[model samples]
Each structure stands twice: as structure tokens, then as C-alpha cells.
Target chain A: MISYMLCLVLFSVGLYCILRKRNVIKIIIGIGIMEYAANLFFVLLGYRTHGRSPIYAIDQEIKSMVDPLTQSVVLTGIVLGLSVTLLLVAIAIRIYERYGTFDITKITKLKG
Target chain B: MEISFIAIPLASAFVVAMIANLDERIQDCIACLAALATLTLSLFAITVLSGAGSSGAIVYKVGGWVPPFGVSIVIDGLAAFMLVTVNLIALAALFYSTGYMKKYTDKWKFYALFLLLLAGINGVLVSGDVFNLYIFMEIAAIAAYALVAFGTTAEELEASFKYAVMGTVASCFIFLGIAFLYGYSSTLNMADMASVLASKGPSGALLLASVLFLMGFGLKAALAPFHAWLAYAHSSAPAPVSAMLSGVVIKVLGMYAIARIFFNVFGITPVISFMILTLAVLSMIVGSMLAFVQSDIKRMLAYSTVSQIGYVALGLGVGTPLAIFGALFHLFNHSLFKSLLFLNSGSIERVAGTRDMGKIAGILDKAPLTAYTGLVGALSICGVPPLGGFWSKFIIILACIQAGRPILALTAVVVSILTLAYYFKSYTPVLFGNVTTSKQIKAKSLFTMNAPMVALTVLVALAAFILIPVVGNVFMDGAVASLVRGISYTDVVFEALK
Candidate 1:
């Protein structure tokens, strides 16, 4: 339960970084941190102390097996995370080329 | 057979990419054919749905394994309606692009990405698995980002970047919500998850998941609070692409997904319904009021899309049979007229060489066809009498009244008047008044551009003609039945799987 609350805190911190940070790269990193917190919380949902893998062998009893679905879900989620990160990096590079800066504060020609 | 709706477009996108080295003409032709094929298949999906009466759901298991173990595509009424709306606009947009996209350099890449986006939308609509929907949504999102940046101008690139950042954040929330749902249900198949949710009842965790999804999909839909990105993104894209984005992409990725998840998967409670209604009213009022201040035609249309979607949301929020019908019908009507209006704006932009409504005066004398279609589209969208928008708005208002929400109904009426005022403010300047600049560039896209606009105009007009008891059943009532049935979805899925 403490860990769940910690995950929420991590998410809030990431949000703060995004809201307060002026650098585009920092904002991207904040997004990444938030995603990691969500992924960690998802994995924690299926965790139990001393729980083994949720797999069955012909010779062994399958009692107290840990939920494995979150593992697969998180794996896919990590791939999604990678793509978003790459996109953000690409956007950051483009911003640098176009405006000659990484500061989002200066990237303000698109008003109204 | 149902899977073919997605497979056809997916295969065509790859084919377009592989043969992109061929001539640009061939690439454009292939894109148009692919879009036309998708439209035909979507119509077929609608036919299949109408014929397959009361039969739970049609599951097309990819590798022939039963769901809960294998990924499947669920073809039902909601899927059919969404497929029709997306593919119809896709067809028209591709046709319009045949001429307009000549301004851009790499024609093949544009077509390939467009088809890929179509595939993503179709996949999102039909997939039974929650994770698969997210993947398909990302595919569409990435393709849209690329398309928005296709012009490579400073403004286009900046808008695309902003959109990408915000869209990625929305996807993160969606993924997290899906993870929570999976954790709660232990299954990724939406129907299977619904069964588990039905058994367990709504928990704090599930409610949290719902809220996350609402926030995520609301961003995607450009609902009131999360709509800042839309005005920029839609305005930055080329006109036809903007049309497709405003007309279909947001609905499929945002509104359709929200409706499917909340109504079918989790079931709508009074609290959730009330929350949706509040968002709807906020979006309608704010989006319209903001639109009234925009001088750029496309930007104004983008805000109007936000406002019209508010009507769909309001209808869905009512959670009654008539209300759902009105919402879905308004959704259908909005897609048709809005896409047509955007295409008209694109045509005007093509001729006038600018998107500012003030500069493009008295175009009616020079471009009669586009002017006619623009007027029809504008009036229809603003809920003028004997047009498509009126019936749906009338039904939505009636549903609000029936549901004992007179204030919501009154708000709908005020927004309708506001919608009319803004649209006319755009229309009268562009279509009537004095012939401003006589730039004699031969406009050569009558078949590819005007034909689709005219066809959609007819469909919008037909909506009014058939709003009576006879034709209303298949068009509106069927959609309402699909939504109002709600979590009876689990039973339908189990029965269909058997």
C-alpha cells in the first residue's frame, strides 16, 4: 500500500517536472518518469510475497502462483514507452533546428 | 470476413509503401483505390450488422483460438457505425487529396501514411482486446503526426510537435488504465473483462481506471478541458487531411473508444453519466463561444468539431434509448457535414491561396460548385431547417427534455444558434459579397473534389428527409439499441462465442 502511494507521488513529481520545467528535453524525461511510475504500479498489482511464476509443470502443483499477465502487459507498455520517447526526441531535435533553442518558454510564436 | 475490413487496408498500406518507388501518379491511384475499397468493405460491414439481428457479437478469432486466450475482432452495430463513418470520410479525403496533395512533394509517402492511418482506425474499431486497441491507436496517432508535419513548415512542425507531446501523454494514461483493467479482470479481451467486472461490481480501482480513461480519451477527443492541442493540430494540417482528422480520427480514437468502454465494458452508472453530461455542456458552450471569435476558416471549423462532439457526448450522457439514438445520429450527421465543410474550406483555400475568411470574399461567382456545397454544409451543421444537423439536434434536445434536464436542452438550443452564427460569419464572407482578387488559376478538381462534397450534401439533406418514423429505425434506433443495451454486452459476447 505504501508502494502504491509512492507510485502516485512519483506520478505527481513527474507532473510537476512537466509543468514547471522550461526545457523540452526535461519535459520528455518527466513524461518518461510518469510512465515508469504507472508501469511499476501495474506490476505491483499482481505481486505477492513468495509468489512463484504462474506456470504449471506436469510434476508440480500450481498453488500460490503469481499473476503473470501484468508482466506481458508491462513488456508491451515498455515498447510503447520507447516509441513515445523516440518521438519526443525527434520533436526536440526539430524544435532545435527550427527555433535554435531547447527552451519551451521561447517557443511561443503560435498564440491565438 | 469481418477481419477483412482491417486486413484490406493494412495490406494496401504495405503495398503502397513497397511500390512507392514507382511513379507518383501510380501511388495516388493506388491510394484512391485502396480508400474506395475500404469504403465498400465498411458498407458491407454495415449490411452484415443489419442482417445479423440480435446475435450477441460476431467474433473473428485471428488464429482460431477462443477469446480469453486469443485476440479477436468483434463486429457489432457500434463497430459497423464507426467503420462506416471513418471509411466514408477516408474515401472522400483520399479523392480530394488526389488533386490537393500535388502541392506536397512526396505523394507516395502521404498516401502510404494515409492508408496506414485508415488501417489503424479500422483496427481500433473492431479489436476485442484492450491492448490491441492502444497499439492501433498509436499507429493512427503516429501516422497523423507525420501527416500533420508533411508540409514541413515552421508552424506545421511546431503544431505537430505539440500535438505529439500531448497525444503521447494521453496514450500513457490510456495504457495505464488498460493495465489496471487487466489487473482487475485477468483478461485482455474486452468482453471477457466486462464479465469479470460485472461479477465483481464497480470497485475503487475500477472507478479509478474509468477516470483515467475519461481523461485520456477526452484529450484525444478534444473535449473542453483538453482541447487546446486540437485547434493547432487541425489548423496546421492540409485541408483534406484536416477534414479527415476532425471528421473521423478523433471520433474513432476518442469518442468511439470512450462509448465502447464505458457503456459496454464497465456499464454506465448515474454518477458517471452525470459527469459526462457536465463535460458535454462545458465542451458545447466553450467550444462554440471560442469558435465565434476565430477568423481563420479551418480553425473555426476545428472549434466547431469540438462543439459538435459535445452534442454526441450529451446524448450519450443521457443514458436513455432516445438519447443514445440522438447522440449516435448526431455523430453520423456531424461526420458527414463537417467533413464536407472542411473539404469546402480546403477547396476555398486552394483557390483563394489563404484560409482567412475575410480575404476570400465573393467566391460564389468564380467557384459555384464549391460555394454551393459550402453553403449546404454550413447550414446543415448549424441545424438549419430541413438539413441533417437539425434532426439530430432536435432529437438530442428532445431526449434531454424527456430525461428531465430542461437546462441541458436549452443549452443545446443556444449552442445551435451559436453554431449557426459562426458558420454564417464564415460562409457569407467566403461565398457572397464582392469578388475580391481575380486570380485566374484553373481549378481542375471537379470530379475528385466537388463530387464527394455534393454526395455528402445529398446525404445530409437525406437525413432530414428520412427523419420520420419509417427510415429512422435502421438509421438511428439501431444505434440507440446498441448503446442502451449496455453491459448486457457480456451475455451477448458469451452467446456469440458459443
Candidate 2:
């Protein structure tokens, strides 16, 4: 229970960073943090107290096992997160190249 | 057979990327052929599903495993309808890109990403598993983020960064929602999950998941409050990308997901319906109000997209048979006109070298093809009589009244008028006026670009004819019937799986 609460707290903190940060790199980091937190929450959901690994052995009977589906799904999520983060970082580098600043406040060429 | 929708595009994207350097012309041909093939397959799927005595859906279990244990691809009435709309626009956009992308340095990369995006969309439309949907959504979203920044200009990079960040956040929320659903139901297959959810009833976790999905997909769709990133992202990308993004991406990823989950999986309750109604009304009013003040043509169209989407959402919110029919019809019509409008904007930008309506004039006199097509699109979007947009909007309003929501009906009428007012205000100066600037108009429009625009314009002009009873009962009714069946959708999928 406490672990789930911690995950929520971490997610909230990441959301705060994304919303409050003015630096482009910081915002990207914030997105990464939020993604990790979500992935962590998903992994935690599959946990079973005292449960063994989900892998099967031909010789033994297994009474309890942790859910491996969420683990695999979370792995995919992490990979997607990595790609998104890399893209964001690449765009940040280009933005710096073009605008000469990482501060989002300074990049105001587009507006309504 | 259904896997062909995804396989063709995935194969083409891979081939285009690997062999792009070897032969440029070959890559273009491959891309067009892939799009055409997908379009043909989608048409075939529609006919097969809609045939009399057919079961109304096709379920292909991956690896031949049964559902609730393995991922499945299910193509039903709704999926087929959306598939046709998506592939049709994709074909047009791919053809247009062949010519339009010549100005850009790397045409192959654009075709590659475009095909990947098409694959992602098709996968989303057909996937019968919740996690599979999210994975495909990510594929499409990532490709879109890269395409938005393809220009590498400061504004493009900035917009792409902002779009990528927000899109990632939305995806995380969707992922979390899927996690909650999986935890609650212990199943990933949508039909099985729906059955589990129905038996157990709605719990706090289920409600929380619903909220998370609302936030996530709502942002993707750019619905009202979550719509800030749309104008920038849509306007900054090259026009073909913009057309795809505006025409098909949001509808497929956002609205289709919303309708599929809320109606099929969760089974829309009165409270959920009310929430959808409120969001729809807010988006309708706010999106149009914001659009009325924009000077940039593409930005205006972006906001207009937000407003038009509100109408579709309203149809879903009403949740009546007629309303869903109107919604699905509008969804189809919007894709036609919106893609046409974006393509027109692209051609105008190519010729005039600017997107600002205030700086350019006399396009009708100079480029009659682009001007007329754009006018058809603009008028169709404004819900003018004898056009596609009019019949859909009229049906939605009528549905609102029939559903005992006269006030909402009145609001729809008012929003329709506001839609016309703003489109006329912004498009008139560019389409017909004195040649204000000395920007020389290119005498000839590229045939490739002009061809797609003309094709879409013809479709737009004839779109209203779909309302003819024979066609409406055949094409639109099937989609409407599926959604109106609501939670019974699980039974349909299970039956098809058998």
C-alpha cells in the first residue's frame, strides 16, 4: 500500500516539474520522470507477496507466481518512453541550435 | 486477411526506409502502391463485413490463439468505416506528398514516416486488445512527433518539442489507465474485459481508469481544454503531414478510442453520457470562438477542427442511434473536406510563399483549381446547403432535439452559424480579393498536388448524397448499429471469434 502511495507521489512530483519548469531540458526530464513513475506503478501492480517467478519448471508444482504480463507490458512502455525522450532531447538540441537558448520563455516566435 | 491492413504499410515503411538511398523514384512508387493496396483492402473489408448474411465482424487471433489469452484483430462495422476514411485520406495525402515534398531535401524519409503512421493508425483501428491499442497509439504518436519537427526550423522544433512532451504525458496517462483496467479485470482482451467489467459492475478503480482515459485520449483529440498544442503542431508541419494529422490522426486515436472504450467496454452510464455532453458543448463553443480570431489560415483550420470534433463528440454524447449516425457521417465528411482544405493551403503556400491570409490575395484569379477546391472545402465545413457538412450537422441537431435536449440542439445550431461566420471571414480575402502583395503567383500548379485536391473536392461536393436513403442505410447505418448495440459489442466479438 505504501509503495503504491509512493508511486503516486512520484508521479505528482513529475507532473509538477513538467508544469512548473521553464527550461526545456527540465521539462523533458520531467516527462521522463513521469513515464518512469507510471511504468513503476504498472510493475508494482503485478506483485504478489512471497510469490515466485512466473517461469515454469517441468519438475515442480507452483502454488503461486507473480504476474509476468504487466512486467512485459511495462518493458514495452519503457522502450516507448526511451524513444519519446530521445526525440524530445534531439528536438531540444535543435531548438538550442536555432534559438540559442534552452529557456522556453525566450523562444516565442510562434503565438496565436 | 485483416492483417493485410497493417502488414502492407509496415512492409512498405521498412522497404522505403532501407532502399530510399538506392532509388528515390522507386521509393515513391512503393509508397503510393502501399497506400493504394491498403485502400483496396479496406474497401474489400467493408464489403465483406457489410454483406448480407455475414456475421458483421472478422476476428483474426494472432498465432491462432483464442481471445482472453491472445491478442486479436477484430474488424467490425465501426472499424471498417474508420478504415475506409483513414485509408482514403492517406492515399490522397501520399499522392500529394510525392509532389509537395520535392521542395524538402529528403522525400524518402517523409514517405517512410507517413507509411509508419498509416500502419499505426490501421493497427489501432483493428486491434481488439487494450494494450495493443496503446502500443499502436504510441507508434502513430511518435511518428507524428518526428514529422512535426521535420522542417527543423526554430518554430517547427519548438512546436514539435511541445507536442512531443504533451503527447508523451497523454500516453503515460493512457498506459496508467490500461494498467488499472488490467489489474481490475485481469484480462487484456477488450471483449473479455468488457464481460468481466459487466459482471463486477463499476468500481472506484474503473471510474479512475475512465477519468485517466478521458484526460489522455481527450488531449490526443484536442478536445476543448486540452487543445492548446493542436494549432501549433498542425500549422508548423508541412501541409501533407498537417492534412494527415488533422484529417485522420485525431479522429482515429482520440474519438474512435473514446467511442470504442466508453460504449463497448465500459457501457456508457448516464453520468458518463452527461460528462461527454458537457465536454462536447464546451469544445463547440470555445473552439469556434478561438478560431474566429486567428489570422493564420492553418491555425484557423486547426481550431476549426477542434470545433468540428465537438459536433462528433456531441453525437456520441447523445448516444442515440440517429446521433451516432450523424457523428460517424460527420467524421467521414470532416476527413474529406479538412484534408482538401489543408492540401489547398499547401498549394497556396507553395505558390504565394506565405500562409498569412492578410498578406496574400487574388488566388481565385490566379489559381482557379486551388481556389475552387478550397472554397468547396470551406463551404462544406461551414454546413452550407447541398454540401456534406450540412446534412451531418442537421442530423446531429435533430438528434439532440429527439433526445429531449432542445437547449443543446439550439446550441448546435448557433455553433453551426458561428462556424460559417468565421470560415467566411478568414477565407474570403484569400480566395477572392485584389492582388494585395507583389508576390508573383506561379502560373502552374503541380499536377500531382492538383489531382488529389480535385479528387477530394469532387468527393466533398458529392458527399451530401450519402444521405440518400439507400446509401445511408447501407454504409452509415452499420456503424451506427454497432455503437447503438453498446455493451452487446462484447457478444458480437465473441461470436465472431467462434
Candidate 3:
């Protein structure tokens, strides 16, 4: 429960960064932090107290095993998160080159 | 056959990347051929699906592992419908890009990202597991971010950055929701999860998961409150990308995901249905009202996307068989006309050298093909009678009335009129007024560009003419039955697996 609360706090902090920050790079960082928080929560979801790695052999007795599914999912999520982060950084760099500033407010060419 | 939907595009994307060093002519030929193949395969799938019984959903287990253990591809009425929409729009967008993308260098990279995005959308539509769905969503989302920043201009980059940030945050919420669901159900397969959820009544954790999903997918769908990034990212992208984004991406990524999760995995309740309807109403009102204020052609179309999606959401929210049919019908029709309209905008931008409506005038006398197509598209979108939009909107509102929600039905009527009003306002200045400006207007390209607009314009007209019989059996019945079946989905899956 405490761990879940910690995850929530981390998520809120990331949200604040995304909502309040004006710098494009900083907003990207906020997104990274949020994804990391979710990934952490996924890992925690599969954790067990003193649980062994989930593997099986013909002779081994089956006991408490940490869920293997969340680990695999988190691994995929991490990879995807990395790609998204890279794309964000690349876009931010290009934005800086074009607008001459990382500030989002200065880059207001598109509007309704 | 199932894998081909994904494999074909994935291979094409790789080939495009490899052949980026080649001459432009070869690149254009490869890109057009690949896109045509995808479109043909999707049409074939639709035929196969039309013959399938509601009880006959096909599941292709990856690596020959049974579902609930390994990943599987489940193709059903709904999946087939969405696949057809995505692929058709992709084909049209590719054709448009062939002409529109000449201005930008490195045509190969553009097609590569486009095909990659197509593969991702198909993968998401067919995946049976929750986690794999997220994976495919990421694939699509990531590709979309790159495509939005393809121009790498200040405005494009800024919009792309903002879109990426908002989209990533939404993805985080989705992942968190999935984690909660997995923790509770101990299964990742949607069918198996539904069974587990049924066995265990709705819990606080499940409620939390639902809320998380609503927020996350809501952001993706661009519901009224979460719609800030859509107008920016959509209008800022190049025309074909904008077409694909507004045409089918949001629908597949947002609405399809929401429908699959809500109606299949988690049974719909009145409260949840009401919440969806409220959001739908808000989107309809806000999107149309806001669109009335936009001068940029594509930007107006972007807001119209929001309004059209509202009709879909409202239909889904009603949760009646007829209502679901209305929603799905509107979804397909919107994809057709919206893509056509976006391509039309691209043509206008190409010919007149501007997207600003206030500055540019008299596109009709200048470019006859684009003007006519734009007129047809506008009529279809505004729910004008004898056009595709009218029938779908009529059915949806009728369904609302039949479902005893007259107020929502009334709101639907008013909003659609608002839709007509805004579309006409945008259309008149560009397509109808006198040609005073002496900008040299020429066709963008013959095979790659003009063909798509012509074909899609024909389809928009054909959809309107064929509304009665074609839509009756193919879309309306299928979508309605899918929604009507509801939680019985769990029973069917468990029985099939057993």
C-alpha cells in the first residue's frame, strides 16, 4: 500500500512537471518520469515477499514465484519508453534549431 | 493471411528504409505499390469477415501457443471493420503523399514512417492480449510522433513535441491501468481477464483501473477536455499525415480501444454509459463551436474530427444495437470523407500556396477537381441529406430517441446543424468564391495525387448512395450485433478456448 502511494506521488510529480513546465525538453523529461513511474508500478505488481524467480524444471518443487508476465511486459514497456524518449529529444533539438528557443510559449505558430 | 496484414507493411517499411539511397522515381513506385497491396489485403479481409458469424471470431495464436498463455490475434466483426477503415485511409494518404511530399526531400523516410504507422494500427486492431495492445499502441503512437515532426520546422517541431509529451503521459496512465487490471485478474488475455472480472465483482481497484483507462484513452481520443493537442498536432503535420491522423488514427487508437475494453473486458453499466454520453455531448458542442473560429483549412477539419468522433461516442454511449450501428457507420463514413477533405486541403495548399482561408480565395475556378471533391466532402461531413453523413447522423439520433434519451437526441440534432454551419463557413470562402488571386494552380501529380482524391470522392458519393443496403448488412448489423452481444463475449471466448 505504501509502495502504491509512493508510485502515485511520483506520478503526480510528473504530471505537475508536464502541466507547468514551458521548456520542450523539460516536458519530455516529465513524460519520461511518468512512464518510469508506471513501469515501476508494473514491476511492483508482480513482486512477492521472498519469492523466487519464476522458472520450472522437471524435478523442482513449485513454490512461491514472482509473476513472470509483468517483468516481460515491463521490459517491452521500457524499450518502447526509450524509443518515445529518443523521438521526443530529437524533436526538441529540431524545435530549438528552428525557433531558437526551447521555450514552448515562443513557438506558437499553430493556433485555432 | 492474418499475419500478412502486419508482415506486408513491416517488410515495406524496412525496404523503404534500405532503398532510401535510391532515386526518387523507384521510391515512389515502391511506396505506391506497397500501399495498394495493403489496401487490397484489407478489402479481402473485410470480405472474409462479412461471411463470418458473430460466434466465429478467429484467433491465431503466435508460435502455436494457446490463448491465455501466449499472444494471439483475434479477428472479429469489429476488428475487421476497423482494419478496413485504417488501410483504406492509408492507401489514400499514400497516394496523396506521392504528390504532396515532393516539396520535402528524402521521400523514402516519409513512406517508411507511414508504412510503420500503418503496421502498428493493424497490429493494435488484431491483438487479443491487453499487453500486446499496449505494445501496438506504442508502435503507432511513436510513428505518429516522428511523422508529425517530419518537416522539422519550428511550428511542426513545437506541435510534435507537445503532442509527444501529452501522448506519452496518456500512455503512462494506460500502462498503470493495465497493471492494476493484471494485478487483480492475474491474466493478460482480454477474454481471460473478462472471465476473471466476471467471477470477481467490481472492486475498488477495478474502479480505479477504469478511471485510469478513461483518462488515458480519453486523452488519446481527444474528448472535449483532453483535446488541446489534437488541433495543433493535426494541422501542423503535412497533408497526408494530417489526413491519416484525423481520418483513422484517432478512431482506431482511441475509440476502438475504448470500445474493446469497455464492452468486452469490462461489462458496461448505466453509470459508465452515462459518463461516456456526457463526454460525447461536450465534445460535439465544443468541437463545432471552436471550429467556427478557425481560419486555417486543415485546422477547421481537425476540430470537425472532434465533432464527428462525438457522434461515434454518443452512439457507443447509447449502447443500443441501432445506436452502435449508427456509431460504426458514422465512423466509416467520417474516415472516407475526412481523408478526402484533408487531401483536398493538401491540394489547395499545393496549388494556392497557402492554408490560410482569410488570405486565399476562389479555389473552385482555379482547381476544379479539388474544388468538387472538397464540396462533396464538406456536404458529407455536415450531415447534409443524400450524403453519407446525413444517414449515419440520422440513425444515431433516431437510436437515441428509440433508447428514450430524447434530450441527447435533440442535442445531436442541434450539434449536427452546428456541424453543417461550420463546414459551410469554411467551404464557401475556399471552394465557392470568385478566383481573384492569380496563383498558378496545377495538379500536384497525376497517378499518386489526383487519383486518390478522385477515388475517395467517388467513395464519398458511393457511400451516400449505398447507405441503405451496403451499410445495412456490412456495418450496421455487424456493429450492432457486436455491441448487443456485450458480456456474452466472455462466454463465447471461454467456450471456444475450452
Candidate 4:
């Protein structure tokens, strides 16, 4: 229970970094942290004490096993997170090239 | 098969990308052909839905796996309606892109990305499970982010970055919300989860998920508070992309998902209704009131997208059968007219080589087809009589009144008038007067560009025919019935499995 709350705390910390930081790279890092938190939470949901790997054999009876479904979900989530982070970094690199700075406050090329 | 909707685009996207060394003409032709194929398949999906009759949803289980085991593709009336809207606009956008994309280098990349985006949208529409929906949504989002930055200019990059941040944040919340749902219900299948949730009744987990979804999907939809990114992103995207984004992307990603999950899965509650209503009203006022202030033609349309989405929400928030029907109708109409308008903007921009309304005055002399199409689009969006927008707004307003909400009805009328004012501000200045040529581009893409705009204009003008009882009854009844059935959606899914 406490670990679950800690995961969200990490999420909040990441959110804080995103909201407060001006550096483009830092914001990207913040997004990464938030994604990690969500993935951690999903993985945690499937955990069980003394649960074995979700393998079934014809010779042995299985009493309890960790939920493998969520592990797969988390795996997909991690891949998606990598893609998003890669895209963000690519865009960030472009921003630095165009604007010569990482400060989001300085990147005011677009406005109404 | 519904599988073809996702398969064709995915396969074509790879083909376009692999043949990068080939001629640009070939890439454009392949992309356009793929889009047409999807459009036909979408029509087939709709036809199948209608043939199955009201309350019929064809469930295509993947690999012959039974329901609640493997991912399924369910094409209910609502999914069919949404698919047709998506693929139709996708075809138009592909056609327009052939003309507009000639200026940009590596046009093949754009076609590949566009097809991938369409596949994501189609996948989202047909997916029966929540996780698959999320995956498809991310695919669409990534493609959209890349496309918005396709120009690679400073402003375009900045806009794409900003949009990515906002969109990613929204997606995270949605993911977190799905996590909560899975933890509570122990299933990812939407129908199965809904049944489990119904039997279990409401809990803290469910409530939390709902709030997270409202925030997440609301941002995706560009509803009131979360609409800031839309103006920058939509305006910065290439013209046809702007059309695609405003026309069907928001509807499919945000509005369709919300309606399906909340109305069909969670069973819309009074609280949810009230909250959505408040946001709808806010979006209406904010979107319309701010639209005319922009100098950029695409930006103005972008802001208007925010408001038009508000009108659709107004119907949805009301939660009456008539209102839902009106919402869906408005959704369909807005896709035609808004895409038409965006394509017109692209045409004007192509000819004048500028998007600022002040500089492009009286280009009607230069481009009569674009001007006239722009006028038709403007009239339709403004709810002019006999036009598509008018009928939907009229129906939504009437639905509000019948639901005993005169104030909401009045609000709809006021927003429509406000919508008219901003469009008037744009068209009168942008399309009229004898003005200079401004800055014209060297390349001429008249045939490829005007063809799609003209096609959309005709559709927009004839859109009222959708409301004719015979057609409307067949076209709209099942979609509405699906929503009105609420949580009974589970029954339909389970029944189809048999």
C-alpha cells in the first residue's frame, strides 16, 4: 500500500519538474519519470508475495502465480514510453538548433 | 472484414516507405489508392452494421479466440459511423496532400506517416479491448506529432513540441486510468470489464478512473481548459493535416472513446452528465469567442475547431437520444465542412503563399474555386439554412429544449451566431476586395488540390439529406440506439460471440 503511494509520489515529483523547469531536456526527463511511475504502478498491481512465475507444467500443481498479463502490459508501456521519449528528444534537439537555447520561456516562436 | 480497415493502411504505409527511392508520383498514387480502399471498407462496415439491423454489432474475434480471451474488433453502429467519417476524410486529406505536399521534400515520408495515422484511427475505432485502444492511440499520437513537425521550421517545431508535451501528459493520465480500471475489474476487454463493473457496483477505483479519463480525453478532445495546444498544433500542421486533425481525429480519439466508455461501458451518471455539460458550455464560449482574433487562417480555424467540438459535446452532455443523434450528426457534418474549410485555407495559402488574412484580401480574383468553396464551408459551419451545420445545431438545440434545458438551448444558438461572426470576420476580409497578388508559390497544384475541396463542398451542401427520415432512420438509428442502450452494450458483445 505504501509502495503504491510512493509510486504516485514519484509521479508528482515528475509532474513538478515538468511544470517548474524551463530546460527542454529536463522536461523530457520529467516525462520519462512519470512514465516510469505509471509502469511501476502497473507492475506492482500484478505482484504477489511468494507467487511463482506464471509457468504451468504437467507434472506440478500451481497454487499461486503472479499475473503475467500486467507484465505484458508493462512491457508494451515501456516500449511506447521509449518511442515517446525518443520523439521528444528529437524535437528538443531541433528546438535547440532553431532557437539556440533550451529555456522554454525563450522559445516563443509561436503565439496567437 | 473489419480487419482490412487496419491491415490495408498499415501494409500500404510500409510499401510507401520502402519504395522511397521510387518516383514521388508513385508514392502519391499508392497513398491515395490506399485511402480510397479504406473508405470503401468503411462503407462496407457501415453497410454490414445496417444489414445486421438495429442493436446488431459484428464482433470479429482475433485468431478465432473467444470473447474475453483475445482482442476483438467490434463494429457496432457507432463504430461503423465513426469509421465512415474517418476514412472519408482520410481519402480527401490524401488527395489534398498530393497537391500540397509537392512543396515539401521527401513527400513519401508524409504519405507513409499519414497512412500510419489512419491505421491508428481505424484500429482505435474497431478495438474491443482497452489496452489495444491505448496502443492504437499512441501510434496515432506519435504519427501526428511527427507530421506536425514535418516542416521543421522553428515555429512548426515549437508547436509540435508543445503539442507533444500536452498530448503525452494526457496519454499518461489515460494510461493510469486504464491501470486503475484493470486493477479493479481484472479485465481489459471493454464489454467484459463493463459487466464486471456493473455487477460490482461503483467504488473509489472506478470514480478515480472516471475523473482521470475525463481529464485525459478532455485534453485530447481540446475541450475548454485543455484546448491551448490545439491552436498552435493545428495551425502549424500542413493544410490537409489540419483538416484531418480537426475533421475526424479529435472525434475519433477523444469524443468517440468517451462516448463508448462512459455511455456504453460505465453507464453515464448524473454527475458525469453535469460535469461534461459545464465543460461543454465553457468550450462553446471560449472557442467561438476567441476564434476571430487570430490573423493566421489556420489558427482561426484551429480555434474554431475547439468551439465546434463544444457543440458536439453540448449534445452529448444532454444525454438524450435526440441529442446523441444530433451530436453524431454534427460530428459527421463538421468533418465535411471543416475539412473543406481547411483544404480551402491550404489552397489559398498555396496560391498567395501566405496564411495571414490581411495579406490575402481579394484572392478570390486569383482563385475563385477556393473562394467559393471557402464560402460554402463558412456558411455550413455558421449554421446557414439548408446547410449541414444548421440541421445538426437545430437538432441539438431542439433536443436540449425537449430535455427541459432552455438555457442550454439558448447557449447553443448564441454560440452558432458567434461562430458566424468570426467566420464572417475571416471570409469578408480574406476572400473579398480587389487586392494584390501578395506572395504566390511557383508550383501549381490546382487539379490535385481543388478536386478534394470541390468534393467536400458538394458533400457539405448536401449534408442535410442525412437528416431525411428514411436515410436518417437507417443511418443514425442504430448508432443512437447503441448509446441509449448504455451498459447493455455488454449483452450485445457477448451475444455476438455466440
Give the TM-score comparing model 3 with the true structure, all chains together.
Answer: 0.97
CAPRI classification of candidate 3: high
Candidates, ranked, DockQ: 4, 2, 3, 1
What CA root-mean-square deviation does each model show from the true structure? Answer: 1.9, 1.1, 1.7, 1.3
Candidate 1 Cα errors over 4 Å, as ranges? B52-56, B437-446, B465-471
Count of clashes in candidate 1: 0
DockQ of each: 0.55, 0.88, 0.88, 0.90
- Of the candidates shown, which would achieve the greatest DockQ relative to the real structure? 4
Tens-place lDDT digits, model 1, residues B35-83:
7887787777666556635573577888998888888888777887778
State TM-scores per candidate: 0.96, 0.99, 0.97, 0.98
RMSD in Å for model 2:
1.1
User: Which sections of candidate 3 miss by over 4 Å?
Assistant: B52-54, B437-447, B494-498
Cα error, candidate 4, residue B459 (Å):
0.3
The C-alpha local distance difference test score for the whole of candidate 4 amounts to 0.91
Q: Give candidate 2 misplaced runs (Cα > 4 Å).
A: none
Q: Best candidate, lDDT-wise?
A: 2
Extract clashing residue pairs from model 4. none
Enumerate residue pairs that collide in model 3: none
Between candidates 3 and 4, name the one with more favorable lDDT.
4
Candidate 4: misplaced stretches above 4 Å? B52-55, B437-445
Q: Is candidate 3 or candidate 4 better by DockQ?
A: 4
